[model samples]
Target: MVEIAMRSYWNEGPTEVSLNGLCQRAGVSKPSVYREFGNEDGLTHAALENYGHCVLAKVLEILAGEDIFAGKIRKIAYLAAEDGAHESGCLFVKMRTAKNQMGEKTQILIAAMASMAVDAYANLLIEGRETGEWPGNIPVKLGAAYLHAQIGLALDQRARGEDPRVVLALALCVLGLTDAQSEIA
Candidate 1:
């Protein structure tokens, strides 16, 4: 029920949703909703945490696949670019924006979620370097920062109504993941 309410609020903005509306959509009583989540803010925070975990799980799954780091990162980039136009560019991104307006507890959760994402990218870069898929000279931390920056840029482009694909391509080029042979596709 909390998840449903959160998804509802995420899809449609907080101002557009009401407790009664969530109860109806979630098929739960008002008291039940209140019992689980004291207020709308509570529901929103829980939802953000749930959504953040979901995104992190998906990223981890992709990274855990059989492909090399470059291939996995490419696939992740494509997926992110494809979904860039909605909800302020991603649920995690939306949560980050919302963190500023949320209570300190919620802000901590959001920061932790963001840290997980950055750490995942850093680990992937380290693996890539170890496997000779990426240049060893490039520090994993720097690579992670670069990848995070690209995500922010992609989200910003989506917010500005710019072409995410073009921006994604440029980002790939900047990351040294693009070459003439790969471009043939």
Candidate 2:
């Protein structure tokens, strides 16, 4: 049901959601859904929570991997790209664009996801700098802000059918890394 809800939101946007259609898509009865999740708002919040977990897990998994700063950034760029599966747009991006129409719970979940992304960027920069991967002079705060901003741009570009590599370059530029940094990636 969470997957069904996410797919619907990503494809149709929340403005077009219909409870009966969602119940049909999930292969669950409306009464069962209502019992489990209360209503459409509850279902939407649950889906957002699921998506937030996926996003947070991906970042945490990457941070624990052997990849360094640039490699991590590159992977992030790829992940941010809009695949054919999400033809309408990324769930988070779509939520952001249609925020005013969203229920408060859904909005809160989206904000949590964004906060998680920022924390991931901050943690990566902190560890990278300590390990001699990131340039020592740049503050972690600045790097985090820059990385988060670039990731947002990357996701937006992907949604618009542009290349993520350009976003990757902008991210690398923010780090002010050398050509040798590609070796780390």
Candidate 3:
């Protein structure tokens, strides 16, 4: 039921979702939902956490695979590109965008949830640098900023109905994860 509500909210955005609507979609009674989740904000908070877990799980799987740093970054870019297919963009970004609309507690929870992905990516970059897969001079802060920028670009392209893959490719090049010369060749 929580999953159903989360998916609906994710696909449609928070403004369009309602507890009654979620109950209908989940095929559960309103009383059952209230008994479990208390209110719309509560449900939304849980949904965001669930969404965050899903995103983090995918990132973990990609990082766990046997691939070079560039390859792993590319894979993560592709995943972000795919996520841009949805209206609200990445769940974490969406939650951040909607922070003002959420309660104070929810806002903090959402921020923490969003931070997890950035932290994971930063840690990956640090590990890569330690292993010589990434440049030793690469600053973790700058790498995290680059990754967040790529995500923003991907979301913008998606909002404009453009191909996010182009954004992803360009982002990789800008981050020095891909060869600019090879792109021209």
Compared with the true structure, all predictions reach lDDT values of 0.67, 0.71, 0.69
Cα deviation at 125, candidate 2, in Å, is 0.6
Cα displacement (angstroms), candidate 3, residue 63, comes to 2.8
Q: For residues 29-129, what per-residue lDDT tens digits would candidate 2 score against the true structure?
A: 99999899887778888887776676547756886678877687556655665445434446776776677778887888777777777787789888878
Q: Candidate 3 regions off by >4 Å?
A: 82-88, 136-138, 180-185
Quote each prediction's TM-score: 0.77, 0.79, 0.79
Give the Cα-based TM-score of candidate 2 against the true structure: 0.79
lDDT per residue, candidate 3, 21-81, as tens digits? 8888888999888789887778888887787677657777787677776677766766666
Clashing pairs in model 2, backbone N/Cα/C closer than 3 A: none
Instruction: Give me the runs in candidate 2 sitting further than 4 Å from their true place.
Output: 82-89, 136-138, 178-185
**Model 3 global lDDT (CA atoms, 0 to 1):** 0.69
What's the number of clashes in each of the models? Answer: 0, 0, 0
TM-score of 3: 0.79
